[model samples]
Target: MAMTSLPSLPLLPLLLFAIAANVALGATIVKTLPGFEGELPFTLETGYVSVDDSELFYYFIESQSNPKEDPIMLWYSGGPGCSAFNGLIFEIGPLAFNITDYEGGVPSLQYYPYSWSKSTSILFVDAPVGTGFSYSKTQAGWYTSDTKSAWQTYQFLRKWLIEHPQYLKLQLFIGVDSYSGISGSIVVQNIVEGNEAGVVPRLNLKGYILGCPRIDATINDNSKLIFSHRIGLVSDDIYEAAKKYCNGSYDDVTTSEPKCYEAIKVYDRLIKDINKYDTLEPKCTWASPNQEEDMSRRALEETSSDDFILSPPKIPDMWCHNFNYAMSYWWANDRSVQEALGVRLGIVDNWERCNKSLQYTLDVSSVLDYHKNLSKMGLQVLVYNGDHDLTIPCTGTQKWVKALNLTIVNDWRPWIVDGQIAGYTIKYSESGYRLTYASVLGAGHSPQEYKRRVCYEMFNRFIHYYPI
Candidate 1:
């Protein structure tokens, strides 16, 4: 098949069936990996869901406890471009790179005790079109916008479920780390609509989970200034000046009044030395001048390859977090690792954690309306933020959640784990809709990367309908 053009709407289902009729459902049951020793304890399945001319790759791990009854969550890493391996290895998955012991050639992997998959089956997908192992047969297929990406993902899920009918009855929840929330919300809403429209296999749509998500680009970026001031990164004098001159909006100071522009320049200088992702971490020296400029913008308006700084510095202890990201490059690029994972030969060259170079357009500025629509549907939601993350500050999350105007059911209180405060949380409800909001104490962007155990505890409680 040429796959020269995308399948038309009328012919998409037939195309899906045609692809599924072939053996194996385009999936591979990965028994062993290059760095991990022995057979994997849980079922690890990797596959490509053919969505028209695009091959969306995914890694599905069965629940460690009981896949038969537990909820199934479909997760994708943000950057709209970051590889799903980021979620699989760094954040919520069972395997993690042993960065501390790395003398490095195909970094060693160790089992993470706090993986969310311990309780729920998780499907981690490389989305949009050109992320990770996912690829497009035609140049046109590689191009995607927020609306198109969401639609493609919805199609991917339906086709995937069709191939694995055992999971058809499982309650489905969408989980997104960072930026994917825009599309994730759209995907959830799409799932609901598809079910109501009597779309095949009727997805048991539940709700969604968003971690330090980018909701409104302007609002999120502007919140960074407030977050920085609140966290003591900006001096009171400077913050006050900026607040007064910038008129409470620091996102586009360049075109603002002269005083406002000057105030913002000072504010930016104050924060220039700090690692905005996690204010507690040291600034990365490995980032190029261009990457630093990109970081300075604090905008999530467009996907860029610079989203993740790939190279690890020689001195690991200085910036251990970014150093850890480098392990994925080392591991994924290895011939043995690719062979073990059943990666198609030569489809992708030099795997990137986030391939922002793909032709992508950020069409949706804010998904707040989508959230409002979902709120009326009687679904549940869990929204979390790392208290110290300036990238998409907790303050911004609070502002938007408050906009929903759901009655506060459970007043704000400290949520505990091991008898110590893990974070603060509040619950809101209206009609049948319920939303839980949390802030992970002292963590940064993507709480799971910094507080895996705490995040797992929070997720465990939320998934089981227990209060957090």
Candidate 2:
């Protein structure tokens, strides 16, 4: 029997995991990885899904409960350029970086008490060829669009299932958030079409999940002003005046409208200091052309994060809240860490949380039609947003959801977590379809990062079709 092996002492664990997986394919089972103090408690497999010349990398974590029985989730990161590691370490993965320090080395890994993988198997993917550890063999393979990404992802899923036949029967969900919302909708549609065509290794495609999805840029941008006004960021005079002058055209304002431009300018200045993604949290790193965010010479340090961990950076009181992401940047880019994860060298010059330099094209600007069609299908859907997220405001999600026109199964009400009001949620059902819309109160973009346990509880119940 041919047995796949990884480097070092972890090979024994890898062999065990491979035997358990039944079909290893070209996957690497990681037992001991960098950052964490000791051996991992759960099984993690890092491998590539071939999509033509491009190799999309993914981190697969088996369910800690019952690997064979638990449902599977394909979690694609948003940003169209951001790595899926955010959804992994920060959002739902089993292990996460303890972000309590700032001394700037490898961020130590710790077991999250409410990891999504406790009962649900998750596949965190770095898609579109250029995100995270995923890369293309040829330069031409890097250029991708909304439509192309969906098809590629579909093909990837099919091939992945073919390789790991044991997991082919698990109930599947395509989970996406942020800018990937556009491609995510298209991807879901592709899966539905594939299933209808009677494709090989038939997928038990159940439903899809969206978190703070940027469904429509026009609506999202316009709702920014509404969200701002509702949160008391701007005065009523400015808000009403902009509405009167701008005519709800936020993205493409005319040069002729000087008053409107000035109003927007002031609004931008006011919120420029705010981290539009998560208003309550620290404003992390943002890149610029002249100089990079973290140019630390003390990088590639993966010995032990305990020795280097420092207190969290002091957030500035002014317009800038500098929550430096040096720790994560260092941890991911470390040579030892990459080797431990079995990452292909020269695939990417560096690992950025969000590879903003990818040549991604915006083919589908809005997913209004997709959401409407999904609502008609006999599928369960959950659309959640951080109420404080100004980028893809819940107001925009609410507007599109209202457009779905489903019967109100449950009227709007506050949902509780630990006896405190966590957020507001509403339920809708039409035909065989059931949709749940929720808002994570006082949380900014990516509610999972802000309220982990609460978001996990929300997801756990939503997936099981229980009351929120």
Best by TM-score: 1
Error of 1 at 391 (Å): 0.5
Where does candidate 2 stray beyond 4 Å?
Answer: 1-25, 101-105, 281-284, 287-324
lDDT of 2 by residue, 218-241 (tens): 788788888889888889998888
Q: What does the lDDT read for residue 467 in candidate 2?
A: 91
Give residue 256's error in model 1 in angstroms.
Answer: 4.8
- Alpha-carbon shift of residue 152 in model 1 (angstroms): 0.6
Candidate 1 lDDT: 0.82
Q: How far is candidate 1 from the true structure (C-alpha RMSD, Å)?
A: 4.9
TM, every model: 0.90, 0.87
lDDT of each: 0.82, 0.77
TM-score of 1: 0.90
- lDDT by residue for model 1 (4-69), tens: 233455775675566567527457889999889899888999988888789999999999998999
Off by over 4 Å in 1: 1-25, 285-317
Question: Could you say which candidate leads in lDDT?
Answer: 1
